[model samples]
Target: MKKKHVLRLLAAAVTMGMLAGTASCGNANQKTAQENPLAEEADSAQTEQEHESAEEVDMVFRGGTVITMLSEDDTDNTAVAVKDGEIVYVGDEEGIETYISDATEVIELDGQTLMPGFIDGHIHEPGNMMTEKKELILPEGQADLDVYKKELQSFIDANPDLPIYKASGMDLQAFPDNIADNEWMDELDTDKPVVIADVSSHGNLANKIALEMAGVTKESTPPDGGKIFFDEEGELTGYLSDAVSLLSTLPIIEYTEEDFSSAMKEFQELANSYGLTAIDSGGTIYETEDPNQYEVLSNMHSAGDLTLRINTTSWAGQPLEGKESDRLIKLLDDSQKYTSDFLQICQVKFSLDGVPEGATSALLEPYTKEAGQEEGYAGTQKATEEDLTAFVTAMNAAGYSVETHAMGDASVQRSMNAFEAASEANGGTPDGVINKIAHVNLLTTEDMTRMADEGVIAAMQPLWFYYDPFFSAQEESNLGKERFEQEYHIRDMIDEGIIITGSNDYPVTADFAPLHAIEAGATQQSPYEGEDDDPAYIRNPEQSATVYEMLQMYTVNAAYGAHMDDIVGTVEEGKKADFVILGDNPLTCDVKAISDITVEYTISDGRIVYQK
Candidate 1:
């Protein structure tokens, strides 16, 4: 017998408890048919008629666990049928046979688990492509400054003909005061401009030549929501915070349409391998100056080349004042031409504050003494609350959702306030609008309730729940032990009825695996080997969520956040046939082993996109 057939028989036997009492089973079967002979005959006739009337499907999957993601209690589903890119039937193995025919392609799960294809609630899509094409991406987790210098010099030497040099992924913790200066980078190259972006992408360190090229000097004023650092002697230190406007002046690589198309295709395949069929491009749409970026995506979608559904956004620029807000609305309106089933541009993104690692995130209280701040020093906000409210109101009224980058408690509160004011202004959040606050690293209990009441979604990165080696110390110093420990109240927020979604914030987070995120969120500890053994690696255990909850964050909640809930997120009839078949059931496995689960197959639009 085939292995699949044997496994099916065994599964059936176990389900029916065939070994418990054969005589009892025979007695029950005999009683059922004999006691109600006419009823049993009617049931058989109904079954035959139903089978004859069943519509044939294109694909059928059985002999495995099916997670519908419809509810926490939905756990018994084991089969699915699909036709014309939509799920036709979702039920038990016997029910799936109704839709099967000789021509139907049957996929034997072989005791695996099938669930909705993961959705990244927040990620930078083409931004990674642009970085790969324009800059030298440094190795992640390199804490040595000398290594960066060496790598930068080597990259410059190899690409001598380039007009300028650019590198990213500099660990801020490796620098003095978590800030870089021009001296060492200037030592690498003096003739050509060189700009190095910190790992967080919230800060940048430019060499003397790059600073000069950008016309930045000691007297130059930084743009709103940005900071240009100076030394004790009042010399430009080449450190910039949230200052992309000035950096754009430097010459960089220009990628063509074909380049972007190729990069997107590669990214799609990579995402599919990770069981991702959809992603919300969180504000990286304007990262590059390429005007044809959206066009490239639209072209691909029109040509049926896109394997991933993308919810794209436009970057709501800094100083989101009245005029700027109006400009953003008009930009989004103009972008409506690109809207399609595979590509959507109905969201706008803006940062309300910087990150805590840089001691720039706006906080409600003062930073600790170790953070190098004055006794009562708090952080700063990008725009005034009035401006933020106005911007949010404009976006909401224009029939779009706003996604804010809010890290500190103050920022989160201000974002909520703005969202609330926007709702009031727009008469209840506009229909179908789902405002989001991303990177809600610090939030108060009151605000959690407020977020739930106001229907605001939290776009969170689960990987940040753990006390990872990179930013833990900085965050602790910046927020103090009490506040730091209170951060990332994922479970609390979820319990308060606030919808939370998961994301890796790709490019920002190099490791973009949902399984890794699921494990980290569940354990609230570092997923890295030998790291979780240290107690410090664990964050607030109470805030840790279950593996199934993390899955919901990546699937159903994310689909709602992206406004794709109507067609995806759950494995149900009439929904898109997007699913990932895993080697093991994450819900039933040991929490620590969740990350080790392999994606055996990824199906999108009723087509097998990946198999392993």
Candidate 2:
């Protein structure tokens, strides 16, 4: 982005000092009786009634630097009033007091920084947390492969009464040699089937018995989007990939309704602790054709166990086995029965490609050392362009938004092409529709222009902007210098007018703190500053955004991406009372310490959900 525009935005924030309320809902500035004289009488009567019943208000928060996120007109030293489950007032302290009474539960923030509740724009709470709760989860990074085997053995022994053994979160990269075959796991537990999944959740390591349980043999044919690996002797190595891994685990692992509910509760608590009022389940359904997770979320909402607002997309292609479009529409339509202020089913999700590490993400150019490919191997496209375009067009015609996982430049380009086709077929994005492309890890200049022109939301993970020591070298080699520098070109998107939003694809990155993402985004470096201070660690320094810009990505922009901007993005009157209080102002804090600043309180639906 331009330095001039950056300074102007910062200047606007500085000018907002101790100002008061703006207009409610859409308008930025409050309209006076002189401006709208026709409603003067009703406004006066409503104000009088509000004052008469001030004591009935639910909660009042004061003595804080409130970042209303009201464009460039937000202010500090403001107080907010909540009644029922909505915000009634966001103004100066004295102005807020008029709506407060003895019955109001008042919270004195003492100069804390208050802003809209954070939103994890792209997360997979259902399958990830459900699996974590039901199965054993090994740590993310383990230098010793034996540690995982020992833990698996201990877990199996401890749960001797149990029927099956399942675990996830193993680092395959760290111990590739050990997982070359199932011999190590077979030595541990040959009788009881044992299945341990890699951290990516796309592959699994199983013992001989587990393979048999899943009905996999040397001659077994892998399903669509799946892979079954074998040794040189044509013997099953018990390594399953992609859709096959998901299908194989179903035989040994069980996800009961109660297990799903418990997992949702666990995930909600974690999100609440991080001050997340809402999260987008980037993809919905278990594998495909199974809305078990959705049913659990619905039941939880009905039982009032749901605390975070959830917006999810229907999964496409996989596990469907050629039945994609029609079933997807039915699932989207059925989800409306469970829709509410806290839960929504909005988008149809498609995976144009996979991740770069797996050499599955479709790329315009070839990878330097892509596995199972010739010298000039570009990646693979999971779906034909015609099929993808048709799906997008069909979903758009049905009035449901679309979002695709596009990691490689080729996938990103094709995804844009699909959205463009949808827009043209539907005569442009209809009202209340916003298409999105998740994980835009690589984007060309033409792709950027098309994204901005079509208003495609860039749902990005700022935490992924930095160079990961484990894979940066490989990534660099795969894309050479010209393309390497363009990796995660966030500022380019911003400059091009793309509505970029933030997320922390939870299981992929252990923590889902928006503050950590903001700090990482600003510096384009490690959140832990001292640990990796090398200049080479910076991915694209010039592309780093200001802290203020990062905050918008977390709040308003994120809400916009989730189709919740009209309700919860900004601290506006008539919006939901979802906001968080921080110990320090991130806008003015030492950039490195932004992550260190704690969430002092998290208020959701006019009630305190978390406090520290």
**What lDDT would each prediction earn against the true structure?**
0.76, 0.70
lDDT of 1 at 184: 78
Off by over 4 Å in 2: 1-56, 126-128, 161-164, 176-183, 208-250, 284-292, 319-322, 370-372, 477-482, 529-536
lDDT by residue (tens digit), candidate 2, 1-612: 000000000000111111122212111234321234543455756865665566457898899889887654466546888899898776678667777667889999898988999887887775567775447887655635688878888787777766677887666455553234677775685377777766555567777777777777777765443556666677777777554434434454556777667777877787888889988777742433446666777888788778888777677765423367788778777767776777777677877666655455677988764253358867666676778888877777776788888878898998888888878988876656778888888878999899878878788887777776555554565567677677778877787777777876766666677887888788887676463467766778888887887887877777766766657877876789999899999887899899889998888787788889
Estimate the TM-score for candidate 1: 0.89
lDDT winner among the candidates? 1
Cα lDDT for residue 517, model 1?
Answer: 80
Q: How does residue 304 of candidate 2 score in lDDT?
A: 72
Candidate 2 clashing pairs? none
What is the C-alpha local distance difference test score of candidate 1? Answer: 0.76
Worst 10 residues of 1 by lDDT: 4-13
